[model samples]
Target: MDELTRAVVQLEENQVIEIVRRELKKGTPVEDIVERCRQGMEAVGEKFSQGEYYLPDLIMAGEIFNSILEVLRPIMAEAKTRKLGKIVLATVKNDIHDIGKNVFKGFAEANGFVVHDLGVDVDPELIVSTIKEEKPEIVGLSCLLTSAFDSIKDTIERIKQAGVRNQVKIIIGGAPVSEELKNWSGADAFTRSAAEGVKICKELLES
Candidate 1:
Protein backbone atom coordinates (compact mmCIF):
# COMPACT_ATOMS: atom_id res chain seq x y z
CA MET A 1 0.00 0.00 0.00
CA ASP A 2 1.07 3.61 -0.68
CA GLU A 3 1.81 6.14 2.03
CA LEU A 4 -1.65 7.65 2.22
CA THR A 5 -3.36 4.29 2.06
CA ARG A 6 -0.99 2.79 4.60
CA ALA A 7 -1.42 5.73 6.90
CA VAL A 8 -5.19 5.35 6.78
CA VAL A 9 -5.18 1.56 7.14
CA GLN A 10 -2.82 1.79 10.06
CA LEU A 11 -4.83 4.59 11.61
CA GLU A 12 -1.84 6.94 11.60
CA GLU A 13 -3.58 10.18 12.41
CA ASN A 14 -0.66 12.61 12.10
CA GLN A 15 0.75 10.92 9.01
CA VAL A 16 -2.64 10.98 7.34
CA ILE A 17 -3.02 14.72 7.83
CA GLU A 18 0.56 15.39 6.78
CA ILE A 19 0.15 13.33 3.62
CA VAL A 20 -2.97 15.25 2.72
CA ARG A 21 -1.14 18.53 3.27
CA ARG A 22 1.80 17.36 1.19
CA GLU A 23 -0.51 16.34 -1.65
CA LEU A 24 -2.16 19.72 -1.55
CA LYS A 25 1.23 21.44 -1.66
CA LYS A 26 2.16 19.36 -4.71
CA GLY A 27 -0.90 20.75 -6.50
CA THR A 28 -2.65 17.35 -6.58
CA PRO A 29 -6.34 17.48 -7.24
CA VAL A 30 -8.49 17.42 -4.12
CA GLU A 31 -10.68 14.83 -5.78
CA ASP A 32 -7.71 12.47 -6.15
CA ILE A 33 -6.80 12.87 -2.50
CA VAL A 34 -10.41 12.40 -1.42
CA GLU A 35 -10.66 9.21 -3.45
CA ARG A 36 -7.46 7.91 -1.86
CA CYS A 37 -8.85 8.64 1.60
CA ARG A 38 -12.04 6.82 0.67
CA GLN A 39 -10.04 3.84 -0.60
CA GLY A 40 -8.30 3.73 2.77
CA MET A 41 -11.63 3.88 4.62
CA GLU A 42 -13.00 1.09 2.40
CA ALA A 43 -10.06 -1.08 3.40
CA VAL A 44 -10.79 -0.30 7.03
CA GLY A 45 -14.39 -1.38 6.50
CA GLU A 46 -13.28 -4.60 4.85
CA LYS A 47 -10.95 -5.38 7.75
CA PHE A 48 -13.81 -4.64 10.12
CA SER A 49 -16.10 -7.08 8.31
CA GLN A 50 -13.46 -9.79 8.37
CA GLY A 51 -12.93 -9.35 12.13
CA GLU A 52 -9.40 -8.16 11.53
CA TYR A 53 -10.27 -4.82 13.06
CA TYR A 54 -12.60 -3.88 15.88
CA LEU A 55 -14.88 -0.98 16.80
CA PRO A 56 -12.00 1.20 17.99
CA ASP A 57 -10.31 0.74 14.63
CA LEU A 58 -13.48 1.77 12.82
CA ILE A 59 -13.93 4.77 15.09
CA MET A 60 -10.31 5.88 14.65
CA ALA A 61 -10.54 5.49 10.90
CA GLY A 62 -13.72 7.53 10.90
CA GLU A 63 -12.07 10.34 12.85
CA ILE A 64 -9.12 10.40 10.47
CA PHE A 65 -11.40 10.29 7.44
CA ASN A 66 -13.42 13.17 8.83
CA SER A 67 -10.23 15.19 9.20
CA ILE A 68 -9.30 14.45 5.60
CA LEU A 69 -12.70 15.62 4.44
CA GLU A 70 -12.44 18.80 6.46
CA VAL A 71 -9.23 19.55 4.59
CA LEU A 72 -10.77 18.79 1.21
CA ARG A 73 -14.27 20.21 1.60
CA PRO A 74 -13.47 23.75 0.53
CA ILE A 75 -11.60 22.62 -2.56
CA MET A 76 -14.32 20.09 -3.35
CA ALA A 77 -16.93 22.82 -3.12
CA GLU A 78 -15.10 24.78 -5.82
CA ALA A 79 -14.54 21.83 -8.11
CA LYS A 80 -17.02 20.60 -10.66
CA THR A 81 -18.80 17.47 -9.49
CA ARG A 82 -21.91 15.71 -10.73
CA LYS A 83 -24.79 16.24 -8.37
CA LEU A 84 -26.03 12.89 -6.98
CA GLY A 85 -29.27 14.30 -5.56
CA LYS A 86 -30.31 14.69 -1.92
CA ILE A 87 -30.36 12.23 1.02
CA VAL A 88 -32.17 12.45 4.35
CA LEU A 89 -30.28 10.58 7.12
CA ALA A 90 -31.14 9.80 10.70
CA THR A 91 -30.83 7.34 13.55
CA VAL A 92 -34.31 5.86 13.99
CA LYS A 93 -36.40 6.75 17.02
CA ASN A 94 -34.87 5.40 20.26
CA ASP A 95 -31.44 4.69 18.79
CA ILE A 96 -28.70 7.09 19.87
CA HIS A 97 -25.89 5.85 17.67
CA ASP A 98 -24.51 8.25 15.07
CA ILE A 99 -21.19 6.73 14.13
CA GLY A 100 -22.47 4.88 11.06
CA LYS A 101 -24.72 7.73 10.05
CA ASN A 102 -21.88 10.25 10.31
CA VAL A 103 -19.59 8.03 8.27
CA PHE A 104 -22.25 7.59 5.59
CA LYS A 105 -22.82 11.37 5.59
CA GLY A 106 -19.16 11.98 4.76
CA PHE A 107 -19.21 9.46 1.92
CA ALA A 108 -22.47 10.81 0.53
CA GLU A 109 -21.28 14.42 0.59
CA ALA A 110 -17.90 13.48 -0.86
CA ASN A 111 -19.72 11.79 -3.74
CA GLY A 112 -21.78 14.95 -4.32
CA PHE A 113 -25.06 14.26 -2.58
CA VAL A 114 -26.54 16.97 -0.38
CA VAL A 115 -27.10 15.27 2.98
CA HIS A 116 -29.53 16.40 5.64
CA ASP A 117 -28.54 14.70 8.89
CA LEU A 118 -31.41 14.48 11.32
CA GLY A 119 -29.46 13.68 14.49
CA VAL A 120 -29.83 10.64 16.75
CA ASP A 121 -33.13 9.28 18.05
CA VAL A 122 -35.21 10.97 15.40
CA ASP A 123 -38.93 10.42 15.75
CA PRO A 124 -40.98 8.96 12.89
CA GLU A 125 -43.15 12.04 12.81
CA LEU A 126 -40.08 14.25 12.34
CA ILE A 127 -38.80 12.02 9.58
CA VAL A 128 -42.20 12.18 7.89
CA SER A 129 -42.29 15.94 8.22
CA THR A 130 -38.73 16.30 6.94
CA ILE A 131 -39.51 14.09 3.97
CA LYS A 132 -42.54 16.20 3.22
CA GLU A 133 -40.59 19.43 3.48
CA GLU A 134 -37.27 18.40 1.91
CA LYS A 135 -38.58 15.86 -0.56
CA PRO A 136 -35.15 14.23 -0.69
CA GLU A 137 -34.68 11.46 -3.22
CA ILE A 138 -33.39 9.00 -0.62
CA VAL A 139 -34.21 8.40 3.05
CA GLY A 140 -31.49 6.65 5.07
CA LEU A 141 -32.49 5.18 8.45
CA SER A 142 -29.74 4.01 10.81
CA CYS A 143 -30.00 1.91 13.94
CA LEU A 144 -27.35 0.25 16.09
CA LEU A 145 -29.78 -1.57 18.33
CA THR A 146 -31.90 -4.56 17.24
CA SER A 147 -34.74 -3.20 19.34
CA ALA A 148 -34.85 -0.11 17.11
CA PHE A 149 -36.23 -2.25 14.30
CA ASP A 150 -39.71 -1.39 15.41
CA SER A 151 -38.84 2.29 15.09
CA ILE A 152 -37.51 1.70 11.62
CA LYS A 153 -40.71 -0.11 10.70
CA ASP A 154 -42.81 2.63 12.21
CA THR A 155 -40.83 5.29 10.37
CA ILE A 156 -41.33 3.56 7.05
CA GLU A 157 -44.99 2.91 7.73
CA ARG A 158 -45.48 6.54 8.57
CA ILE A 159 -43.74 7.56 5.38
CA LYS A 160 -46.05 5.27 3.46
CA GLN A 161 -49.03 6.60 5.33
CA ALA A 162 -47.97 10.13 4.41
CA GLY A 163 -48.45 8.99 0.79
CA VAL A 164 -44.90 9.84 -0.37
CA ARG A 165 -43.41 6.40 -0.12
CA ASN A 166 -43.45 6.05 -3.88
CA GLN A 167 -41.54 9.31 -4.29
CA VAL A 168 -38.50 8.21 -2.31
CA LYS A 169 -36.36 5.16 -1.67
CA ILE A 170 -35.71 4.07 1.94
CA ILE A 171 -32.37 2.59 3.03
CA ILE A 172 -31.70 1.05 6.43
CA GLY A 173 -28.26 0.33 7.88
CA GLY A 174 -26.21 -0.38 11.04
CA ALA A 175 -25.27 -3.45 13.07
CA PRO A 176 -28.55 -5.34 13.01
CA VAL A 177 -29.68 -4.57 9.45
CA SER A 178 -29.97 -7.32 6.82
CA GLU A 179 -31.87 -8.42 3.75
CA GLU A 180 -34.47 -10.06 5.99
CA LEU A 181 -34.87 -6.92 8.08
CA LYS A 182 -34.91 -4.84 4.92
CA ASN A 183 -37.88 -6.82 3.72
CA TRP A 184 -39.46 -6.91 7.13
CA SER A 185 -39.21 -3.16 7.69
CA GLY A 186 -40.22 -2.37 4.10
CA ALA A 187 -36.96 -0.60 3.29
CA ASP A 188 -35.85 -0.50 -0.31
CA ALA A 189 -32.25 -1.44 0.53
CA PHE A 190 -29.95 -2.43 3.40
CA THR A 191 -26.20 -2.31 3.95
CA ARG A 192 -23.85 -3.21 6.78
CA SER A 193 -21.19 -0.64 5.87
CA ALA A 194 -21.32 3.10 5.32
CA ALA A 195 -19.42 2.78 2.04
CA GLU A 196 -21.95 0.30 0.68
CA GLY A 197 -24.72 2.55 1.90
CA VAL A 198 -23.37 5.39 -0.25
CA LYS A 199 -23.12 3.13 -3.28
CA ILE A 200 -26.65 1.83 -2.76
CA CYS A 201 -27.98 5.36 -2.43
CA LYS A 202 -26.33 6.30 -5.70
CA GLU A 203 -27.75 3.25 -7.44
CA LEU A 204 -31.19 3.91 -6.00
CA LEU A 205 -31.12 7.43 -7.36
CA GLU A 206 -29.92 6.36 -10.79
CA SER A 207 -32.44 3.55 -11.10
Candidate 2:
Protein backbone atom coordinates (compact mmCIF):
# COMPACT_ATOMS: atom_id res chain seq x y z
CA MET A 1 0.00 0.00 0.00
CA ASP A 2 1.06 3.62 -0.58
CA GLU A 3 2.31 5.60 2.38
CA LEU A 4 -0.72 7.87 2.49
CA THR A 5 -3.17 5.04 1.91
CA ARG A 6 -1.50 2.92 4.58
CA ALA A 7 -1.59 5.77 7.07
CA VAL A 8 -5.28 6.32 6.40
CA VAL A 9 -6.19 2.63 6.54
CA GLN A 10 -4.32 2.21 9.80
CA LEU A 11 -6.22 5.21 11.24
CA GLU A 12 -2.94 6.91 12.01
CA GLU A 13 -4.39 10.36 12.58
CA ASN A 14 -1.12 12.19 13.27
CA GLN A 15 0.73 10.40 10.50
CA VAL A 16 -2.13 11.00 8.09
CA ILE A 17 -2.19 14.72 8.82
CA GLU A 18 1.56 15.06 8.59
CA ILE A 19 1.73 13.14 5.32
CA VAL A 20 -1.15 15.18 3.88
CA ARG A 21 0.57 18.42 4.82
CA ARG A 22 3.80 17.25 3.32
CA GLU A 23 2.05 16.22 0.12
CA LEU A 24 0.33 19.60 -0.10
CA LYS A 25 3.65 21.39 0.41
CA LYS A 26 5.15 19.25 -2.36
CA GLY A 27 2.31 20.46 -4.66
CA THR A 28 0.49 17.18 -4.97
CA PRO A 29 -2.85 17.44 -6.67
CA VAL A 30 -5.78 18.03 -4.33
CA GLU A 31 -7.95 15.50 -6.11
CA ASP A 32 -5.31 12.82 -5.65
CA ILE A 33 -5.09 13.47 -1.93
CA VAL A 34 -8.88 13.41 -1.63
CA GLU A 35 -9.02 10.12 -3.45
CA ARG A 36 -6.49 8.59 -1.07
CA CYS A 37 -8.58 9.73 1.84
CA ARG A 38 -11.69 8.28 0.23
CA GLN A 39 -9.95 4.98 -0.22
CA GLY A 40 -8.97 4.99 3.41
CA MET A 41 -12.51 5.78 4.47
CA GLU A 42 -13.80 3.01 2.24
CA ALA A 43 -11.36 0.65 3.89
CA VAL A 44 -12.52 1.72 7.33
CA GLY A 45 -16.14 1.22 6.33
CA GLU A 46 -15.36 -2.25 5.06
CA LYS A 47 -13.63 -3.14 8.30
CA PHE A 48 -16.57 -1.86 10.25
CA SER A 49 -18.95 -3.86 8.12
CA GLN A 50 -16.86 -6.98 8.66
CA GLY A 51 -16.90 -6.48 12.44
CA GLU A 52 -13.16 -6.05 12.45
CA TYR A 53 -13.51 -2.48 13.69
CA TYR A 54 -15.76 -0.97 16.30
CA LEU A 55 -18.03 2.05 16.06
CA PRO A 56 -15.39 4.23 17.68
CA ASP A 57 -12.88 3.14 15.05
CA LEU A 58 -15.27 4.10 12.28
CA ILE A 59 -15.83 7.49 13.91
CA MET A 60 -12.11 8.00 14.16
CA ALA A 61 -11.67 7.14 10.51
CA GLY A 62 -14.36 9.63 9.58
CA GLU A 63 -12.70 12.28 11.73
CA ILE A 64 -9.37 11.67 10.04
CA PHE A 65 -11.01 11.96 6.61
CA ASN A 66 -12.65 15.24 7.58
CA SER A 67 -9.33 16.60 8.77
CA ILE A 68 -7.78 15.67 5.46
CA LEU A 69 -10.49 17.59 3.62
CA GLU A 70 -9.96 20.64 5.81
CA VAL A 71 -6.43 20.76 4.46
CA LEU A 72 -7.43 20.27 0.80
CA ARG A 73 -10.48 22.53 0.44
CA PRO A 74 -8.48 25.75 0.58
CA ILE A 75 -6.19 24.47 -2.14
CA MET A 76 -9.16 23.60 -4.35
CA ALA A 77 -10.68 27.00 -3.68
CA GLU A 78 -7.44 28.67 -4.66
CA ALA A 79 -7.56 26.74 -7.92
CA LYS A 80 -11.12 28.00 -8.49
CA THR A 81 -12.50 24.53 -8.98
CA ARG A 82 -16.22 24.53 -9.71
CA LYS A 83 -18.55 22.41 -7.59
CA LEU A 84 -20.18 19.35 -9.14
CA GLY A 85 -23.62 20.33 -7.84
CA LYS A 86 -25.55 22.05 -5.08
CA ILE A 87 -27.20 20.12 -2.29
CA VAL A 88 -29.61 21.24 0.39
CA LEU A 89 -28.93 19.15 3.52
CA ALA A 90 -30.64 19.19 6.86
CA THR A 91 -31.74 17.13 9.84
CA VAL A 92 -35.51 17.21 9.81
CA LYS A 93 -37.71 19.01 12.31
CA ASN A 94 -38.03 17.71 15.91
CA ASP A 95 -34.86 15.64 15.40
CA ILE A 96 -31.74 17.42 16.60
CA HIS A 97 -29.34 14.62 15.69
CA ASP A 98 -26.39 15.84 13.64
CA ILE A 99 -23.60 13.26 13.63
CA GLY A 100 -24.94 11.51 10.55
CA LYS A 101 -25.84 14.79 8.90
CA ASN A 102 -22.38 16.25 9.45
CA VAL A 103 -20.67 13.10 8.18
CA PHE A 104 -22.82 13.14 5.05
CA LYS A 105 -22.14 16.84 4.56
CA GLY A 106 -18.39 16.26 4.73
CA PHE A 107 -18.58 13.40 2.23
CA ALA A 108 -20.70 15.41 -0.19
CA GLU A 109 -18.53 18.52 0.07
CA ALA A 110 -15.27 16.60 -0.30
CA ASN A 111 -16.62 15.03 -3.46
CA GLY A 112 -17.24 18.52 -4.96
CA PHE A 113 -20.85 19.06 -3.99
CA VAL A 114 -21.65 22.44 -2.48
CA VAL A 115 -23.78 21.57 0.52
CA HIS A 116 -25.88 24.23 2.21
CA ASP A 117 -26.50 22.68 5.59
CA LEU A 118 -29.58 24.03 7.33
CA GLY A 119 -28.51 22.56 10.68
CA VAL A 120 -30.62 20.40 12.98
CA ASP A 121 -34.35 20.48 13.56
CA VAL A 122 -35.18 22.25 10.32
CA ASP A 123 -38.78 23.02 9.51
CA PRO A 124 -40.33 21.83 6.28
CA GLU A 125 -41.51 25.31 5.39
CA LEU A 126 -37.95 26.62 5.60
CA ILE A 127 -36.73 23.78 3.42
CA VAL A 128 -39.34 24.63 0.81
CA SER A 129 -38.30 28.26 0.89
CA THR A 130 -34.65 27.36 0.57
CA ILE A 131 -35.39 25.21 -2.47
CA LYS A 132 -37.15 28.16 -4.09
CA GLU A 133 -34.20 30.37 -3.29
CA GLU A 134 -31.25 28.06 -3.92
CA LYS A 135 -32.72 25.92 -6.71
CA PRO A 136 -30.44 23.08 -5.65
CA GLU A 137 -30.48 19.84 -7.59
CA ILE A 138 -30.72 17.64 -4.51
CA VAL A 139 -32.27 17.90 -1.07
CA GLY A 140 -30.96 15.56 1.65
CA LEU A 141 -33.01 15.02 4.76
CA SER A 142 -31.69 13.20 7.84
CA CYS A 143 -33.61 11.84 10.78
CA LEU A 144 -32.57 9.67 13.70
CA LEU A 145 -35.88 9.31 15.44
CA THR A 146 -38.57 6.96 14.12
CA SER A 147 -41.13 9.69 14.68
CA ALA A 148 -39.28 11.96 12.27
CA PHE A 149 -40.60 9.82 9.44
CA ASP A 150 -43.64 12.02 9.56
CA SER A 151 -41.41 15.05 9.28
CA ILE A 152 -39.73 13.54 6.22
CA LYS A 153 -43.10 12.71 4.65
CA ASP A 154 -44.46 16.13 5.51
CA THR A 155 -41.34 17.83 4.16
CA ILE A 156 -41.68 16.08 0.80
CA GLU A 157 -45.40 16.81 0.75
CA ARG A 158 -44.68 20.46 1.39
CA ILE A 159 -42.15 20.53 -1.45
CA LYS A 160 -44.68 18.89 -3.75
CA GLN A 161 -47.29 21.43 -2.69
CA ALA A 162 -44.86 24.20 -3.55
CA GLY A 163 -44.72 22.79 -7.12
CA VAL A 164 -40.96 22.25 -6.98
CA ARG A 165 -40.95 18.52 -6.39
CA ASN A 166 -40.45 17.65 -10.02
CA GLN A 167 -37.58 20.07 -10.35
CA VAL A 168 -35.35 18.46 -7.71
CA LYS A 169 -34.33 15.04 -6.37
CA ILE A 170 -35.00 14.37 -2.71
CA ILE A 171 -33.05 11.81 -0.65
CA ILE A 172 -33.89 10.83 2.91
CA GLY A 173 -31.66 8.85 5.27
CA GLY A 174 -30.60 7.99 8.80
CA ALA A 175 -31.26 5.24 11.32
CA PRO A 176 -34.91 4.80 10.52
CA VAL A 177 -34.74 5.23 6.78
CA SER A 178 -35.66 2.34 4.49
CA GLU A 179 -37.20 1.63 1.12
CA GLU A 180 -40.58 1.69 2.82
CA LEU A 181 -39.87 5.11 4.28
CA LYS A 182 -38.51 6.28 0.96
CA ASN A 183 -41.79 5.42 -0.68
CA TRP A 184 -43.88 6.71 2.20
CA SER A 185 -41.95 9.99 2.27
CA GLY A 186 -41.96 10.31 -1.51
CA ALA A 187 -38.24 10.85 -1.60
CA ASP A 188 -36.29 9.84 -4.67
CA ALA A 189 -33.96 7.61 -2.64
CA PHE A 190 -32.99 6.42 0.79
CA THR A 191 -29.58 5.46 2.13
CA ARG A 192 -28.33 3.97 5.40
CA SER A 193 -24.83 5.32 4.96
CA ALA A 194 -23.39 8.68 3.98
CA ALA A 195 -21.13 7.06 1.38
CA GLU A 196 -24.12 5.54 -0.41
CA GLY A 197 -25.84 8.91 -0.28
CA VAL A 198 -22.96 10.51 -2.14
CA LYS A 199 -23.03 7.80 -4.80
CA ILE A 200 -26.78 8.20 -5.20
CA CYS A 201 -26.50 11.98 -5.57
CA LYS A 202 -23.93 11.61 -8.33
CA GLU A 203 -26.11 9.07 -10.15
CA LEU A 204 -29.14 11.34 -9.79
CA LEU A 205 -27.21 14.23 -11.30
CA GLU A 206 -26.05 12.08 -14.20
CA SER A 207 -29.58 10.81 -14.85
**Tens digits of lDDT, candidate 1, 1-207:** 778988999999999999999999899876567667777887887899999999989888878887887887776677688878999999999998776687778777877888889999999999999999999999999998999999999999999999999999999999789999999999999998777788899899888
For model 2, the stretches where C-alpha displacement exceeds 4 angstroms are 1-16, 26-68, 80-82
Q: Write the per-residue lDDT of candidate 2 for residues 1-207, one digit (tens) a residue.
A: 788988988999999999999998998876677666766766776788799999888778867877877877677667665688999999999998775676677677767888889998999999999999999999999998998889999999999999999989999988679999998888999998777889999999988
Clashing pairs in 2: none
Candidate 1 has a TM-score of: 0.81
C-alpha TM-scores of all predictions: 0.81, 0.74
Q: At residue 175, give the lDDT of candidate 2.
A: 64
Error of 2 at 37 (Å): 5.1
Clashes of 1: 0
Best by TM-score: 1
The lowest-lDDT stretch of 10 consecutive residues in candidate 1 is 29-38
Q: What is the C-alpha RMSD of each candidate to the true structure, in Å?
A: 2.8, 3.5
